[model samples]
Target chain A: MFGDLTVDDNLRLGAWQLSGRGRSRRKQRDTSWVYELLPDLVRVRARKAGGLSGGQQQMVAVGRALMSRPEVLVIDELSLGLAPLIVADLAEHLTELNREQGTAVVLIEQNARLALDLCSRAYVLEAGRIAAEGDSAELAASPDIARAYLGEAQGLPSPPDAQDDPGPDDPGPDDPGPDDPGPDDPGPDDRGSADSGSHDRATADPAPTPGTAKTARGNQDTTVQSARAATREAK
Target chain B: MSDFLVYLITGLGTGCGIALIGSGLVLIHRVTRVVNFAQGTFAVVGALTAISLLDTGLPHGLAELLGVAVAAVVGLLFGVIAIGRRGTSPQAALVVTLGLGILAYAVEVMLWGDQGRSSEGLSGAVTVFGARIQTHYLLIIGVTMAVFAAMAALFGRTDAGKALSACSSNPYAARVVGISVTRMGLIAFAIGGALGGLAGVLLAPMNSVAFDSDVALIINGFAAAVVGSMHHIGRTLAGALFLGVAEAMVAGYGSATYQTVVALGLVLALMIGQAARTHSVVAEAG
Candidate 1:
């Protein structure tokens, strides 16, 4: 029933006890009906069912079950290992069958996104038990819903707030002070800074306001001092 | 030139027998994928049975008819036993048919002994284009032609034939469509056996009838079928004709002892043809 038989043969094998006349009629009707749903199968109608692709074989298997005119169709892992596009196509047909034929379809799938999209209502199973139940949209948006149904991990803390941090006005040790020595100002340990400090005062006092000059001088001396410290560290 | 014509006529006669046997082989192979090695044995058994019955005071036609009927029944039995038991393993079925061939031949040897027996030809003769062809040869040709025509009609124009073809193509699908593959297999075997019996009846008068005579006929028939690729009936007939003509040419131009060598060479050529086709299939797959 599962292997080597053609699609039509598989169907006939399932319904063998029917009267010969009735069997042929049923077979023809089923063939046309199945072809209508999955037109690609029409080409391989005479081909062995075992030789078809995974998706086509699945359709044949489903078609065999349908030939019995079963009230309920139970398909396990409808999207298992199938390409997304093929899964979507199969899902559309299943939905059509469900709506028009009133054939109840139980589709089990691992792709939560696809399952949620196709199914009207779904049960999220965890460890073999129902963990949650709801409509698709509600399930898609819930935080806990997102975590469980969408397979996202729960219980991770959020990052700290950006608005409450200290303002940029406060300075650290790197900032220049008003009393900071000029380049030519004599230092406790005299270097070239003592010579450069008088020259700066001479050029600065007449050129700009004294306070602005003093701040400018202090900034320059601090920069030079930092450079000296960096060079010493390198050496 | 007269000698050449004689060789050609002889080749044609032998080719007719080979054609009949090859067609039957193809029929069975198409449906069940097994080349029934016992096909020739069935033929011999049927012919010997007819001869034995004639010796017992039965009318010749009645004995022949009874022989054909018995052969058909034997085919049905072989179908039931060999095909039913082995299913889809063509190789296993081939081996089983080989064993059955041995069994049938041994039984014939036990009943008739190893001596050669001559039987009467069908009847009458006619001059065809200045060649005095025997009435039996005409009968063989006419009967084989009719069989081929009937087979073409059966397979081409009948519902039963289509169903059988479906079963052969895909047993599962055939089963699903409500065809009983087992029943179809039986039909194939019966047809093949009946054809084999017909070939034996045609050839029995021309050659010495013995227990081991069927082996050569079966081998030649199988070789012809293989040479034709076993798919086309026309090709199969052509292969039989080719083999027959080659054998006759060898017998005429070379020593009679070289006949076996010619046959062996023909078989080797067929095998090489099959091997070459198989290599192409592998290359395509790769």
Candidate 2:
């Protein structure tokens, strides 16, 4: 994200990939489409993203990636330094995105519980190598995974289930593959990167500062409730 | 009073030229992060092209237009050589610009000889208040304002301008969003060249420009650019105009020989002050 540029400008530049041959215009999706996905961003569209709060900056970052309308959305790390509630809200948006856009998302996170909650399948990366890979629930239950990520060995109460579960109306695991680009492909067809399954990734990376105020365990309750509320509003 | 007016007005005229050159420098450096040593050569190209066209009976406006166009093409070529290839660092490109400046001197000397040339553009003088100054000075000031306003509009109100600005503010983020950094760099250089060329043609009517006149011209531009943070147009213009006026006032009221010395000395002081200010700011932020 261009911190110096307005939220609108940052999102608009994403279209440069395959739209209008560098002419600064998208064929099907307009830049306003991003504001539609993240409605809270509209008021601050003219403000520079650099001066915005971490949560707003995260919104701008995700809105920028979605402007390209990619079939495969890859988020490196989603939970770094962000408030738990903010993370949940973003995850819920991602869930909604997956259901609506049918874009396959590969979200990599350092938080094991969040990753497992958001993803059906998971992989544990250790020292640049895959340590363990399996179903999210299975990995969560494994003693080794449980000890390392879930804090089960330490006897910490299990955190409530994250927004990874789809509601009655939303379809992600059941949706058609992203590989099957429907007749109305919103993005450039030549984007060779392809993927399977569905998840509209909206990784709102809280720009790692010195560190954020600790709001982890206390916010976890509201995090779940708001995540569900967001899913409902999205539906 | 008359003497003061002459010095002040003429200083502003030269100051306008420096601002144009500095604006070019800032624009290119802001986008590409390359310090082009050949910036002054652009003015030489424009002025010489205009002068050469006079022999062929082309009108003044057309000749000047062609001169600016030629300079823009040269700027594009400079961009291609400096940053066109992958892996060309800004340091490497800066060195290449120095070489290109030398190359321009060779071409200029071969065509126009090592001697100086001047043209009586917008011939005659205009009276201001109770004093008289060249009509050309008014033209220079007018044109400079128009150019700066256009530049401000381009960067502030246009999408292409914002994207170009984005290429510099956060280049890594810019690439992630799919902006062609190289293409934007080329555009900045071309615009820089046109501005340099405009300054040269404007200055041609006032003084004799030699093959090596760029050495002196660029000194003024670099000072203005450095003092202005090399990006902010309004500040660069203000700094350049002050330098021009100071140099002119010194020439008018004091010794002409000390003009370059005075200009350079002021730049050194301004540079040190800015550095100290920035250092203190960072310390406070920390």
Candidate 3:
């Protein structure tokens, strides 16, 4: 295969010659469709492949594999060296493929957040062994599972449904403080509504703040530790 | 006027060989993403092989064919060795190609004993427009034209051509479609090597063959490739012709030592062009 060939020609080479399926016509159509999805590739189709950016090269590699119409698609590292936005877009597309085509994709990724978000079920492999396995939600909520795959220092948040339930507020028969209103004072419906609203706020408010605070604190701690270490070395 | 025409013809002849080598370098870079420093060595090896066979009383045509075949094998070996290792850094691969070039030069020195050998003229001179020109020049023009035409047809009219094109544009997509990148790389190297060999054979009669000639030829070829952006063969050929003419004119008008300086200036110009374009792209992206 010549490197100087047009994009369509290159696609056809992998299509007809590599697969030996004799789908030259279909391959051309497929290439056009691919161009529709990745329009930037169209302008550069006539351009040499070596002149393309790293992301574009990754797209070409993925497109070439798609031409074979395989049941199982295995991408070595989906997020490797790509910008975050492009990786997110690619992950979204892969999810669509999974939903529409039922294609089983084996995506090996070093980014745990991406993997957990994209896959319905996952196995966390550490040192080539399955350290943990469960549904995304279950594993996310499991503290033990999080500690194993993700470091304890990772400070991963619990899943949305894993929040603590509010206990019933019972007023004792003997006495009540002025600030503490009796349960019957507000009526059952008002009391119930207020209780639910407060519960929602209590659960949602601290969740995000703690995560951010943890990150900020971690950064500060690292900076302090490094400074201390430098001072010690100087001494 | 006649003298100018004679120099033009000579430049064109040299340009043909440079274009072939430049195009080969571009092709290898397209597929493997490495600037092969060994390309000149491959050319020299091809020339030496042909010379050895010719010295043994073999026909020139047969000797040339064997030389091309050997060069193809060498190219295949290079592709396998340099590109086969998964995750080989581009810098490491370039260093390896340079090493291979040195190795090839050493082998040539061992075989031919570092002596300058002149080849017999390729079918004598031909008269064109009242000026004497070598038939070899016409051969070079004809061969280069034919090869470019064939490449255009292959790339524009064939399936394998499209696959290669796609591979270059987006390797990941190509792989997802099941293109064997390694196989494509091998094919790219073989074709590149064959072209380099052809250039060597075409150039053998024009200059004295020596082990060290590889470095200059490879440098010139790389410069040509860069000047053309390693894309269009026609542009690469045009660039080579331009360089050849400029070099000849400089040699005629000034000291020969200035030719290297001129060539260096051309390289600097091309690099500046590349950097400016890259800077603009960054700005646009921002």
Candidate 4:
């Protein structure tokens, strides 16, 4: 479905079962929420999903599912074939979605550290048998359980702070996360940093002041975005 | 040049009919991955239904619509039997459509008999570019264009249309996105059937439709669809028009018997070309 369809259309199909007033309402709410959740998707909304990179495709897939407004979203593998940073960013979005929308997410992951970090409850399956089940914090702390499944290969040190976001110095996925600036939180600092990283180079020759830099960066972003949209339309 | 113009105009009408059927074939194949051999049967049934209804003093327009509706119902039935099963492979579904075609043939024979049937199509000739052409041919052209336009809009502007295309692109992902693949398949078959029926109703007056006439219609339509690689609607229509014009020219310039040879040769050459292209692409990818 994603392969040949535009990101917008793919998102529309997610809410296929809805129609009439319900459809329009659901479509407006879910689509806006998805666009907000995955801002990168906004850039490539008109582009064919097949043309997108694998990570972009995955984001579209997640966003598409979210458009359905499912009460319990079952994701097959949240971290598959993605960089750990991307996985972290996505997990953060999922957490935010859960918190804001009260949408439950069931993530099936091989990466136990990430899963334990994001989820409250944990269930371990080995050879079609239930190996262990407990609170995620207890499962993560258990030496025997961690050794058996979450060993050196699957092990990545779980973020120590629960719900405490990475700091400004941390140039990890969180800093440039699309879902970073929630509606309530005005992360002006993060925005400045993100603009500096992506838009600074383009505007460096002109050496714009801090006051104009924001608007200049906004203009450049739109220009680049529209250029991409034009190319897509031409295609 | 006048003679050529006459032939081209006539060919355009014939091409429109063939293209309508080919479009149906292509639509079904695109969504369901099934080459519906029974598409021609939809035309035969529709024409027959319209003709039979005309005998009951029904208006021509209403009869034609009824014919299309009947064809859509038959399409849904075809979908249920052929594509509704969970494990049915495309190959299996294709064979089922063939069986349905045979079933339609039997039904046509029972109801309409083996004799040729005709309807009171618009009778009169119009002069265009110093050449006389049947007015009904123009109607056929108009109808085909209208149908194509509607389909294009449906696909391009509508959410349902996008969902159908999405189902074709990846059924698993489509399902995950909450699209019912079975529903899309059924809709595809029904739309394909309606298109086939409309083609039949339009072509009935121009050509005497017998029970077995579908064999020729399917053959020509299939030939055109194969030329487009069974995906592109515009390309399929163009292929149909090309086949129609080529057939008409061959019949006019040479003999009617030679037209079959030309069609067969064209199909063979195009299929081979397509095969070579696909093979090279696959080799390159590998």
Candidate 5:
């Protein structure tokens, strides 16, 4: 809808039908308020919206939505096709708006890192099913979550056991143990057991990466064998 | 040279009428995404209603106003049926508009019969540099100018216009912002219908307007809009003027039967030219 309309007019249209106050007062309050939030828009108020950059247009889109004083604002793909810096700036505004206005904001984003960072609670939808849902921090710390998103859990230190199990019926006993190999080892008396213990730990965890050694063949598989040998030799 | 001036001045009258209708077409299409083949039905209906009212001894201006109002209401109804619901596909809506136009034509024929209708326009002719011009032609030109000025002001300076433009630009976003896109489409239809009605009144006296005559006006108007890519208002007006002048010249120097052919040919040539220009720009970018 970016025609030859001036940016000011485009913004005004966002709240055009909203009536209760005097026309001039409403115009002054709503438009100037938008300008206050998006200061960059103020400089280009007289310019046509059609000539604006994609980022600017997106800002206008958000500004326009805000003018309506919506109870719940839903934004789709807040980061899609946008620069990282721009997305960050927009996220800042969204946070500010949510805090100040008590506006419920629902953001749909493909960038998991940004989404998990910005939201207090998040849901991960896979094939229309919610695969995961919880406090953002809790979800981020889960070993399975880490394995799925942040790479192998063995590389990172296991956090405190606060992540909610996916369900009551499926309590994953060995899932967290692999990440805490020091605590999970049966005993220190048998030095040879450490190598077999690591092997057992890798097998117990279903994650493909650390378990790849048992399944693969060729030069890469030999390297893995040598790495295990080296670990055993060091022990 | 004087003969050329006469033809040009005469051409402007027809050009103004076509431009007004073209503007309505563009506005409706922009808002509703429907070509609205029934758009010219407004003109025919308005003219016939006004003519009928005039025969009953009503004031000419009042009759014209009422006619335009009738057309606007009719347009609003059309919009509701064609575009009100969310689930109706745009293609389906376009077909509905076409069906409505056909229905209007049949209804007009049944009501007013096949006889062409005419009105008594302002009779005085003004001579300028040896070219005698009808006062009605001047009125048409003046009225069209006024309408364009009003439209520009509405679109450029007003909140309502901006809302309308917003609906046209991004209906989903407009709805998200609480603008009723369906209502905007209805408003577009209303304004578009009024313009079409006004065009019919301006052109009715010059030609005996009948039920089927709207097709020619719609064709010329649609052709004019195509010259401007169906979006630019100023360009559409200029395109209409150019088409009118060229058609008049062909009528003056060649056979009257070639007028429709010339209009269609001009549209094709302009389309080809625009397509080539677009291709070249794309080629450069590539």
Candidate 6:
């Protein structure tokens, strides 16, 4: 998003692909659906994105992505530098997007607990390799994952973990493989949601794990943000 | 008093012309971070092309339009050579533009020869508060005002304007949103050339253009643009006008030879002052 641009301007830029050619006139300039997804942006859309609060800026980011009406949303660090309350609000919006719009989310995060909570299936990594890949619940409960990552990642310094932020040229791995072949349909609203979390630039990444891994079930529009795991899912 | 008015008004005309060029520099610098030395060459191309078209019996307006279009194409070529590659640094692009500007001189001289060209624009004088000035100067002022007003409206009120601005605001984010930074930079260069061309065509009546005339034009224009840090249109306008009127005043009251010295002096003084200020601002904590 352009920091100098108003929230409105930033959101409109997301629709650049649709607005260029002979697209339908109705969808060309429309941003009403984006406003609906993030209702709080209505009043402040006229304000510059740089001036907004971190949470509001995050909303603008998510709203801008939603403007593309994309099937998948990839975020580098959703909760970075944001307050916990704001993260919860953003998490709920991500869930709403996944539930209401069926937008698949790829959340690259250092917080293992947050990632496991939102995803139906997860791949836990150690030393640039997937130590475990299966149902999110089983991985969360596993002692290896708990001791290696989930339990120890809380408020701790960054361990030897893979970085987020997808490189366009080399995005790492595309598939974590169909090893477990877990549920694509977890529950009524158990579709993937990225609970906004951040690897704060000011503070160190709090991952206690050795590294990161990425895994995706669906075939289209998978955006991997992990340095190691990015090679697979991005294709 | 009328003598002073003549200098002031004429100076303002000169100022408006320089402002047009300065605005072009501002736009290109804002988007691409390239200090386009070829900016004044754009004006030269526009003026020369207009002259050639006029010789072909094209109407004045049509000739000017074609001239500006040709200049815009030249600007696109500049962008292609300067920043077409992904890894070209801004400094490298700047040097490339300087070389391209010099290269353009050869092409221009080969095509037009070494003669100055001028067109009698809006012939006759308009009387103002006891001072009679050419009607062409007023046209220059009017056109410049209209251009600036249009620019303000485009950047401030329109979505396309905002998108153009966004290319410089946060390039990475702009890319993530699918705004092509490279394409936008090219558009900026084209617009810059067109603006420079417009300035040149308008200025042809005031100052006859020779093949090498852009050397002085760019010097003055770069001075005015530097006053605004080459990124702000409003400041560039103020700077251009200040230098333009000051030059006129110097020529009127003192020596015409000292006129260009003012431009050079301003740039030198401003750079030293900024460097000194930067040094003073720097502090080390143990």
**What does candidate 6's lDDT look like per residue over A98-184, in tens digits?**
778776666655545456666666775544556678877777677665544533332322322332323222211222111111122
Q: Indicate the worst ten consecutive residues by lDDT in candidate 1 chain B.
A: B170-179
Clashes of 4: 0
How well is each residue in B1-286 modelled by candidate 1, as lDDT tens digits?
6667767777777887888788788888877777888888767877787778888999877887787777888888887878896334678888888888888867788989988775787777666666666778767767777888898888765556755665555454344334566788889999888888878777888887788888788888888888767656778888887887778789888977887678769778778978998999889867
The TM-score values for the models, in the order shown, are 0.64, 0.82, 0.62, 0.80, 0.76, 0.80
Pairs that collide, model 1: A5-B172, A6-B173, A9-B173, A9-B176, A12-B176, A183-A197, A184-A196, A184-A197, A185-A197
Which 10-residue window in model 5 chain B sums to the lowest lDDT?
B170-179
| Model 5 per-residue lDDT tens digits across residues A98-186 | 77777666665554445555666766665455677777777767766555543454422332222211112211222211112231133
Identify the superior model by lDDT, candidate 4 or candidate 5: 4
List, residue by residue over B1-286, the lDDT tens digit for candidate 5.
7678777877888999899889988998877778888888989988888888888999878988888888888888788888888656668999999999998888999988889999877789988888887888888889899989999998877777877887676554455445666788889988888888988887888998899988999999999988878777788899998888888888877877998798779889999999999999889867
lDDT of 1 by residue, A119-154 (tens): 666666654556667765566556775553343433
Model 5 clash pairs are: A1-B169
Cα distance off (Å), candidate 6, residue A124:
1.4
Model 3, B1-286: lDDT tens digits are: 6667667787777878888889889888876677888888778878888888889999978998888888888888887788878667657888888888888777788888798775665778877677788888888888888988888776667666665655564454344344555687778888888888888887888887788888778877888888878766667888887777777667656767897579658877987998899899889867
Candidate 3's error at B243, in angstroms?
A: 0.9
- What is model 1's C-alpha RMSD? 28.8
lDDT of 2 by residue, B138-222 (tens): 9999999999999999998777898898888766555556566789999999999999999999999898888899988899999
Task: List model 4 lDDT by residue over B54-93, tens digit each.
Answer: 9899998999999999988988899899999875788999
Q: Lowest lDDT 10-mer window, candidate 3 chain A?
A: A194-203
Which candidate leads the pack in TM-score? 2
Candidate number 6, chain A TM-score = 0.62
DockQ of each: 0.02, 0.21, 0.08, 0.19, 0.12, 0.20
- Chain A TM-score relative to the true structure, per candidate: 0.57, 0.62, 0.56, 0.62, 0.61, 0.62
iRMSD values, candidates in order: 46.2, 11.6, 28.4, 15.0, 27.3, 13.8
DockQ winner between 1 and 4, please give it: 4
